[model samples]
Target chain A: MREDHHDQPHAPDHPMTEFEWRVDAVQALLIEKGVITADEVRRAVEEMDARTPAQGARVVARAWVDPAFKARLLADAKATIAEIGITVGFDATIVAVENTEKVHHAVVCTLCSCYPRGLLGYPPDWYKSLNYRSRAVVEPRSVLSEFGLELRSDVEVRVLDSTADMRYLVIPVRPAGTEGMSEEELADLVTRDSMIGVAQARTPALR
Target chain B: MTRVHDRGGWPGSGPIDKSEHDLSWWEKRTDAIASLLMSPEKRVMRVDELRRAIEDMEPARYEQSRYYAKWLHAIETIMAEKGVLTREEIDRKVRELSARR
Candidate 1:
């Protein structure tokens, strides 16, 4: 009889350790083949880590200054993002959701981390973790609390499930004060977690 | 001498010659295969399930890669083919993919 192991998926479930080993072996083999240099791979990981969507930053900036653009972003994110020179397209579509003080919104790919990457950036480890994925849909309030965001029951907690055709990024309500801030300054106000609706954009603390 | 400049590493970093990296040809093929398999698919999977899918595809030569890699690749390829990723975007994603460990 053939070895059943060949036909079966590995047992013991969620073998992350084994998984890491396979990655190591694959990397080692790649190194042996000269397909990718160690430096290239290292740079790649760092690049991935450092890459935040400046395009996304611009989008938030526009939303802060241009009412028409904000209207367009709310109407259709893909087009509005493109209008601002941030070209967003792909198997994954992008949609911008809004959050007001009275009503807060959050996004979760209860299925996967189906984020608006073109307008966002690298997903945080927490976004891709099982803890966030599983709990967000079932208990939005508790999860938001852990992330340090709490909403009153009167404030609806809308959750959007990112799918193949459409993904979401949250456009938070601009913070109070600082009406005269520059575009770059406003962009600084937009954080990755905020765009994903996990947290709110915080203005600098008062003196 | 005909000038050819390297553009692999991020800005302010030195150039990256795809050649200097010491991945094996077989390993390169594996990486390519991994890259191809790792592109994003139309499927929506839970994080745990996504992890399992990556684990399952790990040894398939062309069928499996880490979950995020394959997922990103598929999305890249599909979008590019559809004119979604665009030429510049494709180049960027390729750089991201190559740089990504």
Candidate 2:
């Protein structure tokens, strides 16, 4: 009987919880009813798995190297990102906020985990945590500091709340040095935290 | 009126948990299920509808469930509401799977 469980898809070492079992049951029934095919589920999982911070890094690196593209990304993020071959299936508008010496920007979806999943994969656990969702809007400096990003007094901190219809991706300023580095190399320096605006892009020395 | 799901600026929510774990197999499948159901080709439900379901959860239950678990709750709620699947059918399926184990 236990072996039968192993034969099942996504069987865990321990017994599945009620919620976990419900997830399986939902999928099974949905497939049975022809609402969604197993193949479609597999394809969706693969598509989501394929998306990662790397894609967002590629976009940011391009913006760092190309002034024209940066302007376009800020002007129209949804279409500009699509031009780079990243498919955004949803209709939510993505806004690219630039982090400069005078201003810093961080993103939080206070209502729910409304991230730009099409570009940066799923939101991190902390991004969806109540602490972040509650404090990011009111006390962004403290939140950024916990992420090891200490901004100077002169820099204005802006916390962008991601709504159901709007998502924000922060473009951290390029680190000092590495003047002649290639776009690929620059992409390597763009960490996920940096793009979320909790931290800045990695300096060349750190990379 | 602020709902339980609307937690912006609620104060003293504590520090952000930086730890991250790889999604469990069921969690991944739940996400995939949601994406496919809400995909343009299927249009069985919209993201907004799913979100509304989540927001409609009781405050205590909403806070207790894990992230993907909340999504599952939402999916089940929407499915039942849309007449795609009933709670009774899902309950029976769960029992069937449990009996096999």
Weakest 10 consecutive residues of candidate 2 chain A by summed lDDT: A1-10
State the displacement of the C-alpha of residue A191, model 1, in Å, after optimal TM-score superposition.
0.8
- What shift in Å separates residue B15 of candidate 2 from its native position after superposition? 1.1
Candidate 2 lDDT for residue B50: 91
Pairs of residues clashing in candidate 2: none
Candidate 1 local lDDT, residue A201: 84
Off by over 4 Å in 1: A1-53, B1-101
Give a tens-digit lDDT track for model 1, residues A38-85. Answer: 555554443333436566767887888998999898898887788866
Give each prediction's DockQ, rounded to 2 decimals: 0.03, 0.78
